[model samples]
Target: MQLERGVRTVKLKDLPEPKPRPSTEGMTRITGRGTSMLQSKPLINIVNVVASATIDQRLDLKDVQKKFPELEWNPDLFPGAVFRLKSPKTATLLFSTGKMVCTGAKSEKMARNAVKTVVQKLRKGK
Candidate 1:
């Protein structure tokens, strides 16, 4: 049906009102687990590890920086030393207290490798 512009064919009150929600008293919860077609492991992304060690004495960041080419340290800005490694790829932070924080490792194996690499390098540096 064609109507003239700016005209109401039906009254606003004539429109049907929304029905109220049904009561939940008659409902029953499903007790059994549902079957699944997909059998894939859950995605576990972004794993990080923070570790510490107690050295015999306070570690010198400058010395670590000088020894490891991959290490970056600026005593004027921060007291921590950073060693970044590729291959299972992670960045480890070394502090004067012999504390270390390893981040960016995808899995526990990668984190262990990163920590082991750092410890091995530090041991060799001594």
Candidate 2:
């Protein structure tokens, strides 16, 4: 069938070089090769995670301010309302556009829990 779809050419380079093994025992073995080994887990602490959410309804900052007087809202400085939680220890930003930004959580799990707490509070009102 058409000469089995034509023929192809191949080339092989000549082996012309030789290298010596490392003199150290660590390098010769499979493990403990300098500081290049990969660890099973990372070695740092989780401190902060920023998360966002968009609500379907719009918000009124003036009404929200009256409802939650503890929340800090300075229209001259910033547009969003700043709410700080003591439980998970996170600072959340609530916008009138029904958007939220949460930060300063110790871990991913904590960050998610903090966001849930904020939403629950918003739904339940002050």
Using lDDT as the measure, which candidate wins? Answer: 2
Give lDDT tens digits, candidate 2, residues 83-116.
Answer: 8899999989999999998999878888888888
Can you tell me which runs of candidate 2 are displaced by over 4 Å? 1-42
Extract clashing residue pairs from model 1: none
For model 1, what is the C-alpha lDDT against the true structure? 0.72
RMSD list, candidates in order: 12.6, 12.3
State each model's CA lDDT, in order. 0.72, 0.78
lDDT by residue for model 1 (1-58), tens? 4444476575555657555355433344344475423333445656565544445467
Best by TM-score, which number? 2
TM-score of each: 0.56, 0.63
